[model samples]
Target: MAEHKDYYALEMKIDQMIDELQGLCSQNGLSNTAAEEVVVTSVFLYKFLSDKYMHNIEKFAEEIGESVDEVLANENDELDAFYDAYPTDVVFHSTDTIQALINKSGQPGFAAMFDDTLERISNYQENDKFKVSTAGGEKEPLFTRITENIIDKSKRDAFAVAIFGIISESKFDFSDAFGGNFDFYSTIFEYLIKNYNVASGTYAEYFTPQSVSSIISKILVGMSQVDDNKLYDVLDCAAGSGSLVLHLANELGHGKFGNRARVYAQDVSTKSTRFLRLNMMLNGLTESLDNIVQGDSLTSPSQYNVNHDPSSGYKKFDYITINPPFKMDFSATRDEIESNWQDTDRFFAGVPKIPKKKKESMAIYLLFIQNVLWALKDNGRAAIVCPTGFLTAQSRIEKKIRQRLIDENWLKGVVSMPSNIFANTGTNVSVLFIDKTKGDDDKVILIDASKLGEKRKEGKNQRTVLRDNEINQIIDTFINQKAEDDFSVLVSTKDIKKKNYSFSAGQYFEVKIEYVEMTEDEFNQKLSGYVSDISRLWNEGHQMEAEIKKDLGGLIYERK
Candidate 1:
């Protein structure tokens, strides 16, 4: 990135404020150094041209109820109020000037803004659009997938202006969007994940996680279903902004999940973890936020937080949902995973050993698949986004996983999505629904929704969503286990296993393929012309060969 020359001025101002706040806070037992760190980050957010902070600059300033300078001047007594004001949860020691310098780098704290965890958060945009599927002739946002981008407040105005320029010809989905501005997510966080970097594969406009308030609402709906409510865990292994958890807490009408489905979110990124806490608090979900922890859930539980484990000792969940990075490599940790694998372990059955060179092919998601299974209770269910490859690819391991579920649990159904279901990324995704316990029938349902709705106006770059009727079919397929000639099919696990665990719908169901008809006369004329040209060329070649032979014979006689 081109370094911002103006950041020096901004940083200096915050540095001065930090000194003032330190002096004021000393009597109250607060470190002036920590206060300075806040000022430095706030300044960096305002002056830097980072996609992460520039977008949310003003909001961060407003939320904290003071300019970056004022925070630094405030005393230790103001620490709680200051923390309450900002929308992030980063802790800074008074002496941690190194961290201030690090934040100035404009890097994501971890998950490399483009890492798979952040990718999962970004993928939700396309997933949400694709998920507006059919269920029993009614239109509903499937799974209520919401997308957001949070940034430091300073750049909100400029970033909005920039987005306005980029989308000059395009429009935004303000109707569905919580706020009128498309840049709302920019102000959500300021801490960079320790390792996050932007990737070419990222579909989201920037590095910010999807908005916390928006995602939690969706999980609440899933948890609030009329019957049993014990299933919702508000789980996010790559919880970027803690948006889903925060939103879920707000969405809860009353006692929910028997308070059983607590928000359990983790990420390898300390920046994300801290931001998750801040967002949870900013959104009034801090009580639930305390339940949110940090760690690499895909790996074995972190050694730092040793008390809970989804594998063996921790309480089991009723509902689990997460957007883990798709297809990451863990060849290095394979052995460690096996040795310390949890008792109620998500990887109870263990994964096939993949060669180190071909580890990318190992599909990091396979670990998530096993982990989710281990995390669930006998009555728990999970709905997750799977790449189309999961449905089309055939492998011994995939089949083994499927067989284990068919022979043991409820692998309820598959929902095929349109090509642009996740156009921001290469792989189009489908939803994999697995029930730890079968509802009534043992058979699984399938719905082919390659064609959902009109392409959305705001993002002409890709897809639209499903109308009410289309959404209804999805619900009906799962609810009734009905087959719609080409769109849906209900099959037993035994039958799927007979086909060697094939999940490809087109192979089992004859999907319609549109063909173009050509006139017979046009075809015949073209064929005849090609034949005539070939014959002429053949005769020319024969004449050239005869001439060459005659010349060779003449040369031989002359030599004699």
Candidate 2:
């Protein structure tokens, strides 16, 4: 190797590439889409270079020889190794000294050997495996392609698996090594799943995507003010790929809640279960790995609830967050969830008839609703994701569920998300934030976040990612709710009944910016007039029905 150059020169060279790329793109009239690709890819390259030559600019100069172009040309599969040559953190100091340390510490050697040996150890793993890891896993995942923009079936499968693998380390960056460098989803399910396959078993579903993740994180962070640190029994009843609960560990941070706030993540799919564990490890949340499990919220119960009921002194979560499959039918098999509810002891005061088919009925969401209630401690707060069907359906079945929850006072407020939040499923979904212990029992806060995200390219997944600021707005609305004209509403229990108990956020709220200016008294007069008109019509309609009935009766009598 050669003596290194200064960090400033190295930084300028990368910036120079970006500026040139920008000019070239501009000359070509590149679309925003195309330009974005170049920018991100360029950033990735720069990041690689910065990591590789942070201390050893001489190494970069020598590697480049005549020009940076020549150096880049020589890189192929070996590019990854070059980039991994130095830890980005190590670059803050001198290059010569760093290289000496790399040679001396055996750290570089261990990493190199690990890289070469991982393949052999991972031969048994396939492309779409999801696994689990210990608490010390990586919060910022290695080799996940979440920000990539490609969205085909193969990519979908890969992204789905990758989503699971990073959490568990079940998949070992296989896709990162093999999959073509296409950008669309934040990561590939297939690649990540196989890259981190440390699961005890295997397959219910793939990973939940970024759009959904943002919504989930925002809710938990919002709930942190009232975040019951002692609520360690955290559960993602619909724990797809295990990312949601693992994220909980990351968001809550180490010691944010001390050892008291542990997570218990469950998914119906073996793949998801595996990924959940892997995610825990990748996110350095392995302490809760043992707590992460696989179970069907709708139909099956794992050993956790049956063998380790919290009431029996087994510790469970204080908060439960779920993003269950939307519109899944488990109506026919409601009774099959023996561990969850059918076990008479676990069954609550209300559960509807099981659907006939697990695939088509909405029973899965229902079971999740019931299960979360059961899983919660007396005052646990749960922020679960369910489709608009849960909030808007007008069937007797739905009514009973809503009633049961409200009667039990487990129903809290609901947060309505933007359309296309899932980006993949495309179903209109909402976040139902419930408190096992009721706060103010008479009102429910409803927020419509439909206007929050930017347009997303993946399937119905939109991108209204709630940053801390946006999340605060929502939390504040819920905490000190006064209905806004076009965004949020604080509806009383009586109003819910007046509106037929429909919890569709859009039905009760909107983002229509049109201002209807009027004094309170003016508005009240208009409301009173409308009410009087409706009453008059009701009376008239009754009179008309009576006259029709009398005529019909007289006609019948004459005929007799």
Candidate 1 lDDT tens digits, 1-560? 11233433433333443344333334333332333333223322222212222223334557757674455445354444544553332333222222233332243332121122223322434223211111122222211111112234343333323322222212211112222121222232322211122235333321223322232244224423534454345465555655444444444433553433456666665445545554443343433544454556655343214335545456566566555567656777777776776543467556668675867766777777777776676777666656767775667656667777778747777777766544355466666777766755568777777776556533334644565576655655555567888788888777777877767666678657897677999889988999999999999999999999999999999999
Worst 10 residues of 2 by lDDT: 177-186
TM-score for all models, in order of appearance: 0.52, 0.54
lDDT per model, in order? Answer: 0.49, 0.51
- Candidate 2 per-residue C-alpha lDDT over 1-560 given as tens digits, one digit per residue, 9 for 90 to 100: 00123333433443444444444334434424433333334223223323334324345546645444443445553334444553221122231222223333333233233223222222323211222322333121122332233333233333322222221222111122212221111233223332222222221135554445555665655554644444355677667666566555555554554544466665655545544554443343444654554555445444244336645543345677777665665544555554445445344535555555555654556656666766676767777778776787776656766766666666667877767554355567788877666666777778887776566443222344445566667667776755876778877666777777777666776545667899999999999999999999999999999999999999999999
Looking at model 1, residue 383 earns an lDDT score of: 60
Q: How good is model 1 by TM-score? A: 0.52
Q: Candidate 1, which ten residues in sequence have the lowest lDDT sum?
A: 141-150
Those runs of model 1 whose alpha carbons end farther than 4 Å from true positions after fitting are: 1-197, 205-232, 242-253, 256-261, 302-312, 342-345, 352-361, 453-482, 510-560
